[model samples]
Target chain A: MRALTWQGVNELSVETVPDPTVQSPTDMLVRVVRTVSCGSDLHLLGGYIPFMRAGDVIGHEFVGEVVEVGADVRRHRVGDRVVMSSFIACGRCWYCRHEEFSLCDNTNTNPAITEALWGFSPGGCFGYSHAMGGNAGSHAEYVRVPMADHTAFTIPDAVSYERALFASDSVATAWTGVELGGVAPGDVVAIWGAGAVGQMAARVAQLVGAERVLVIDRVPERLEQVRRYVGAETIDYSTQHVGSELLEATGGRGPDVCIEAVGMEAHAPGPDFLYDQVKQQLRLQTDRPTALREAVYQCRKGGTVFVLGVFAGVVDKFPVGAMMNKGLTVRGAQMHGPRYIPRILERMERGEIVTEHLATHVMPLEEAPHGYELFKDKKDGCVRAVFTP
Target chain B: MDGSARWTAALVGALGIGGASVAATRAVQKARPRPRPDRWHAVTVDRAPADLQGVAAAPPEPLAALGDDLEIDLRPAPGDRGTELRARARRPGLLVDADVRDALRRSRSLLEVGEVVQPDEPGTTRRTVTSLPLELAIRHGREGGRL
Candidate 1:
């Protein structure tokens, strides 16, 4: 089987690897149909997480066909078309029962690695580095999905694989932030980063009745996409003052919900960008909190700030004083995919969630390196690169 | 000449006493290995205390593998948490922290999820020179958190 592997920092190669088998009682083998690249993958590609090993398969968001199922898998037949959540979870765990599927107690095989880092390890996530669970990623000819009853869901007949693929991670992640941030009807929502996840967050905010959805990004095309397709206002942070703009947009009150979708490796303008870059390169900080600090400072007093971006470790220059004095509630998590994927798929089927446009570049899995180059560099307006194995 | 001969004999006698004392100490140490930390390793299972009553006596296969070398205790966790399964090695043979934690973690998974989830089997990762250290770390890293 051919799969894209992480060779080193920013080095990806499509290699022929042995095919996966249904290894566990609840495992299921899925033949890849469509897999997409994510903004977060850039961090893995850049070696920010440090858990990725050479030759490790890299991909997560995907829709596929079930090739085989273990005896304990009670989900679907072998031929069923399904969209899998990037995060693998056991359906029977206490966390799964509480709809916190990402925090499953039984999935992460290498828990000690993340346990030492994050206190408690989250569930296994495919192609997400060893810390998230060293499970083989979905960007392969085939992948073995464990505990499939919860991890993979049957794609609705009306939904295309391209549309359902985003539900695997992007849309579900956006919904996670929107709900967790407690975006209320008629409340204003401001989101940082106009990538696929940020676009989805804006759309989700509107779907959940946020009166005003504003997406901030330095990218012209992404801001355009947010305005035209997602029907959200755009803030070109490269030119405008984010704090002043956010305050002005909300009539001096600021947005009720502020979401930072940009992760540790962010592109910020001016002197802080250079400072963060130098600090990150020097290993003085594990993550950059430029967007996070801005979110905390710009959010309305007593508002909620939800972090959807993936951060590996501690950050410097976090606005602790503003976060405290402003009566803010800051929360972040790896997406609880199962809790929201179903609803997202249903919405997709109804033509409410349009994600096909996010696939700016489509190519074979062999061209994954080039696709990632376009994506990582944000060249050719590559919001996401969809792959077919 | 007599004084020199006496000094040499005394030196040999001192070395002999020291060697004998070292051998005796090693023999005693071998009879009883050093103890690990006295802290009890515990996991809170979602199952009620009633289900875990007398669990130490019967014990699951994980704890049972340690046999009498491990001591087991079960108590109800406060505020509807669950049963707390606590264990500590009795004489430190196979119940090292890593092994004990893995066993306890597997016990929790087995009881909760009905089975332990396997990681990617027949791992497809082709070994590179850089990957060896991560693989080495993973071999010793089964205990999820509290590791």
Candidate 2:
């Protein structure tokens, strides 16, 4: 099987890799159909995620067909078209029972590493990194899905494979962000980053009764997509001041809720950006929280700030005082796919949300390295690059 | 027969039947123990010629073919730290040594899952030679429910 692997920082190659098989009782061997690049994958490509190893196949947001199943895999059968919840969740665990599938107890096969880093291990995920369970990613001809009955969902006939693929990670993550923000009727929601997740977050905010939404980004292409797909107001932070503009737009109250979709690799506006960059390069800080700082700083007092971005390791210069003084609530989570996948699929079927624009480029699996390059550099107006095997 | 005597006889018969059934079930289980899955062995080799620059790096094979059922992986550890070998058994009862089997299970859980899940709370990752009563008390204090 040929799969895209992380060779080093800024280095990716489509290499021949061993085919994946069912490894556990609840495992499913799925033939990869479509795997796409994600904004978060850029962190791995840029060496921000420390756990990635050379030759580790990279991809998580994908849709596939079940080609084989373990004896205990009862829910899915061979030839079933399925979309996997990027997170590996055991359905019977305590967290899963409560619908917090990302905190599942039994899936993170490598708990000690996370326990050492984060004090507790979260659910295992496909091909993110070893720290996230190191499950083979779906960028190949076939990938193994553990706890398949709980982690993989059958796509409804009404939903196309391209739209269903977003349900696997991007849409679910954005939905979780919207839920965490606690968007309400007539509320004004502000979203940072007009990338795939941010665009989806904006759409979900509207669906959840947020009357007015604003998407902030510097990229003209993404901001245009946000306007076309989500119908939300756009803010080009590079041209205009973000905080003052957000304050003025919300009638000086600021956005009722702020969503940070930009992860640790965010680009800051000026001199401060260089400080974070140098410190990050010096291994002084594991993440650059430029957008996070803005989200916290610019959020309305007594409002919620939802973090949908991926942050690995420690961060410095967090605005805790502002968060405390303003009575702001902060919430974050990895994509709890089981909690959101079904509902998002139903929304797609009902035509409440359309995600066809997310995949701007489609190519063969051999072009995955180039796909990553285009996505990482935000070149050629590529919102996302989907690869077919 | 007296009424009391008849009731007592019925109670005794019920107890005898229950005891006999339990004993028979235990005897059957002892006669045929449930089979255990075949445990494959795995180990880490600290390959030489290690250098910070231009290391002999290879991609981690997330999945490898060991047999029709078994899957194996040989990947460079995180950051090209070292090489790790992981193998799994498809069938029950392989010829791997007992100590090697336990080590493989522990390492595989760490490599695949992230942690070696403990059966109960109050259990330490450390190997302890504490008394049984202390261990039981610790487990009981942590959580009363059976894991």
- Predicted complexes: DockQ each: 0.41, 0.02
Candidate number of the best DockQ:
1
Write the residue-wise lDDT of candidate 1 on A228-251 in tens digits.
Answer: 889999999889888888888899
**Proportion of native contacts in model 1?**
0.72
Error of 1 at B89 (Å): 1.5
Indicate the docking level reached by candidate 1.
acceptable
Best by TM-score: 1
- TM-score computed on alpha carbons, candidate 1: 0.91
lDDT tens string, model 2, A25-129?
667788989999988888888878756656778899999899999888889999998999998787754467668888775676554456546756687888887
Each candidate's lDDT (Cα)? 0.87, 0.76
lDDT of 2 by residue, B72-123 (tens): 4565656533455555555544323332334443543444343343321121
Give the least accurate 10-residue stretch of model 2 chain B, judged by summed lDDT. Answer: B119-128
Q: What value does the lDDT take at residue B88 in candidate 1?
A: 83
Ten-residue region with minimum lDDT total, candidate 1 chain B: B128-137
